[model samples]
Target: RIIEGYDGLGIVSTIDPGQGLVVVWVTPDTQDEVTHILHFFPRALNY
Candidate 1:
């Protein structure tokens, strides 16, 4: 699913069933803006 920020910044967070990993894609400019997205999925936890 895709989640967007209040400012219209966002990221596409998806679980790659075949890879067994959560893939996150965002624009280079919004790399820092994706912190919240990363937090939602916690890098410490497994996808």
Candidate 2:
């Protein structure tokens, strides 16, 4: 549930549903990068 919210951000390196834990690696270092990520994955932003 938690990771789903960050669907457009980055990769999920690790997850523990029981503990409600999630690790994400977002690499949007610049404005353009962030725009690209959101552009490519529009559904993620809606979530």
TM-score per candidate: 0.39, 0.33
Question: Quick one: best TM-score, which candidate?
Answer: 1
- lDDT, residue 45, model 1: 49
Residue 23 of candidate 1: its Cα lDDT? 55
Question: By TM-score, how accurate is candidate 1?
Answer: 0.39
| lDDT tens per residue, model 1, 24-46 | 55567877756655567634643
RMSD list, candidates in order: 4.3, 7.4
Model 1 clash tally?
0
Model number with the top lDDT: 1
In candidate 2, what are the lDDT values of residues 1-47, reduced to their tens digit?
44346456555554678865555556646435545555675354421
